[model samples]
Target: MDRVLLSIGHGYSARALARLLKPQGWRIIGTTRSAEKAGTLAAEGVEPLIWPGTEIGPALAQATHLLTSVSPDPEGDPVLRQAGTAIAAAAPRLSWAGYLSTTGVYGDHRGGWVDETTPLTPSTERGRRRVAAEEAWAAVPGLPLHVFRLAGIYGPGRSAFDRLRAGTARRIVKEGQVFSRIHVEDIAQVLAAAMARPDPGGVYNLADDDPAPPQDVIACAAELLGVPVPPEIPFETAELSPMAASFYSESKRVRNDRIKEALGVRLLYPDYRAGLAAILAAERAG
Candidate 1:
């Protein structure tokens, strides 16, 4: 293993992975569409390439592992649209390739449990686009593809605590509305495990053991912070952004057995309670 990871759309989850891998001798090279983010990655010891603008010749040639976390728009996957030829050229040398997808692909499971084998019946256009993107990567000849359907991602700087502190926390009660989530650290572990045990053409669901109600998570965060949980508003009455409202339309508890059984991953924060507590502790330490 050369220990070189080329991360496409190096954002939150990818950054966490970089932090874990760096201390263990992995060289992280990543792409960002913005100049500011490129500078940020450079400061973190990642060799940042400006995608859609910069040529991916050197990084693609050198990367032993590849991870793409970019979401597809209506047009299609920006990465494949931008660098298909270059990626194809580097395919034979790449050891493992991962596409970060969403669990929303199993749309509105009515709070029922869903696994990797569940047929994708996405209700949102976003989920439909993701399904399209997954197929796009799979069709790329000889690319060692692994699709990870990630549940809601919450972490250090992006948790319910931030919302609570900023006075944006709301308890929107929708009966039977439950969501599965994974900590960014857990996501990093899953990706690392997959890299260690490469399974070409594999798909895994990334989620914590607990599938819980949305309002309960907010209440838990408030409790941890010793703040009053905001007044609960019925889902129909609560004013929400279209994006936020879209989330309420689906309900599913995603199973993560494959990641544990295949990749040997034990989640560091197995539930929102543990995840939120760790985030608060980290903030206090700093």
Candidate 2:
């Protein structure tokens, strides 16, 4: 059985990946900042390690695979800054290492498509931090690093359906506004495939087939939920939180062809509609 170590494994994407990998006979070791979440992870059949610092444990040093979902903080990523040296010391044991990043690193493409070769021009502090972390991880000698630039990730419980049901959904219209998205399942599959291939120092974009207007996604969600579509408001006139407003300022279409062609992954949910329907069905069944 393959041994896998997840440095920041308590996230949505990491949890999903653990679930999928466990069934395939992989021994999973997951790190969590909280002791409570560590206990919860142990109960889920993963070997939970408390990692509140950047140090790497003996178990992590011996693991064959690693996945990091920790986004860099403005101050710096303690985990990467600290463990990076330790991991580099044990790089020979690592078969593959995956770093999760956001498509925001590509910044605004003016609704144009971008791929792995796109030069990074991150607009936000968070995006800049991620780019820095990517460079840091890639510097680890002998480690096969794979960077996955993920678009907006949606899945069963983390979709627009929840917002629509609560009547908080909004269609904020900004001209030339578009964003790409990928289902969480597809994210897991892509990461798993990348791990299997062990691509040395490669970057790949993870997005769905369509990059549509934000309003379109919201309208579709309302239609699927049998709720009235929320009224559209001009971007300039809409009241948005700082985080929400920041999203509207950028327009980029991320391409996933490299991941598809390299990993031979066929996305189960290619668009928001298919993903939303599956989530709705799962919710109803439960």
Candidate 3:
């Protein structure tokens, strides 16, 4: 049996990946910070284990593949900080290892396009941390580490529809600003494809074909729900949370050609339109 260990699997993208691989005869063991999340993973047919609780002895030795979706904190990459040596020691048994990163590592491109080879010039603290984390993982000796730089991820309960219904959706318009996004399903599919074709120390950008403005996506969701689209708020005057405002600082259209060419990935939802429509359709069916 193919055994994979997902560090920080309770997150949105990792959970989706677990579902995608479970049916393929893969035994998945996911780590979480809490027993609450462990129970959730268990209910979804995944073996959940608490991370940083015990030495990752059995899991690390048994895993053929390992993936870490945990983000870097001020202290640095959490997983690497905790188990870097153990992970390196177990590299002989591990066929592939993956680290989930963000496109923010490219920093503010002033609405230009960026690819995998783009220089890391992050403008935000979070982006800087991600860059540092990516480097740390790459330096792990003998670990077949592949880095996936993900764009804005949205799916199911996390889409604009939920925000609109919750009365928290905003049409914050920053002039000449567009952002690349990826459906969660696409991220899961791409990871699966990468697992099939392991590439050590390869970096791939996971983004959709369409890079749209924030306001336009909100308008589209409103149209789907027959709700009034919120009035456009100028980005300069909009009262955005620190985290939300930080997103506006960067504007880059991320290219996903590598995923397509290398992984042979045909996206299930190529753009926001297709992605949002699928979310709405699923809601209606439920």
Candidate 4:
């Protein structure tokens, strides 16, 4: 079988995965709605297709692997709604499939730890939608699906450094609250490893070992930048949109032991400190 990945709803995470697969001579077909992003993906050596606007059946026909990072809404999963039937038909032909899910599906754990076996009891509608989406994707027979529950993704342009430099980084003090995070590269590598060692129906939580308070991460970013650390703003007092506040509502440490054990993977940036430092060094290098 040819190594071809049909990536639906290709975004930041999928782009990182492509960076790894493209070097290995894998043909990547990533979908995007924007013409500009399509051009960018093409520049990165990925064959981009305008999706939801174009038929994905042709691409699905040729794919040996499938990956989707699309989020569901009040209605349902877009990939399933648009190409679910096509994906179902392509399942038997696919060697591997991956669904990019959020750890939010595990819901709040009161700063406690959660593993892949944890039950899905999301407090918010967003989390509920993820649980629903996961089930929907798994329902496809012979899909050889692997679900990855990702932590807060940080790297390059999307790290705390950008917020600090832009004077928007906040040290929100929510006592007894902490969250796990993973570097984008780490996530990319883990996904690649999973592909190399396909374990269908496997669900892995992708996160660094360290789960620290949100404020500490912000403080470290300021110190690294040699800027004044942003003052602590109590979570309640902090002015935030509903979406931002929702992040504060849930607090849990996500365990990534399965990825290390099952895939024999070691994290590149294990903690926020190392992750932030690399971002800073990359900036100074350029």
TM-score of 3: 0.98
For model 3, residues 130-244, the per-residue Cα lDDT tens digits are 9999999988889999999999999999999999999999899999999999999999999999999999988999999999998999999999999999999999899888999
Q: TM-scores for all candidates? A: 0.98, 0.95, 0.98, 0.98
Give the range where candidate 1 is weakest over 10 consecutive residues by summed lDDT: 50-59
Q: In candidate 2, which residue ranges exceed 4 Å CA deviation?
A: 53-55
Tell me which residue pairs clash in candidate 4. Answer: none
After superposition of all CA atoms, the RMSD between model 4 and the true structure is: 0.8
Candidate 4 local Cα displacement, residue 121, angstroms: 1.0
Question: Which stretches of candidate 3 lie above 4 Å from their native place?
Answer: none
Candidate 2's error at 192, in angstroms? 0.8
Error of 2 at 231 (Å): 0.8
Query: Candidate 4, residues 166-213: lDDT per residue as tens digits?
Result: 988889998899999999999999999999999999999999999999
Q: For model 2, how does the per-residue alpha-carbon lDDT over 179-244 read when each residue is reduced to its tens digit?
A: 999999999999889888878888989999989998999999889888888999999999899988
Task: Show pairs that collide, candidate 2.
Answer: none
Worst 10 residues of 2 by lDDT: 1-10
Off by over 4 Å in 1: none
lDDT of 1 by residue, 1-286 (tens): 5689999999999999999999999999999989999999999999899887888878988999999999999999988998898899899999999999999888989999999999999999999999999999999999999999999999998989989999998999998999999999999999999988999999999999999998999999999999998999999999899999999999999999999999989899999999999999988899
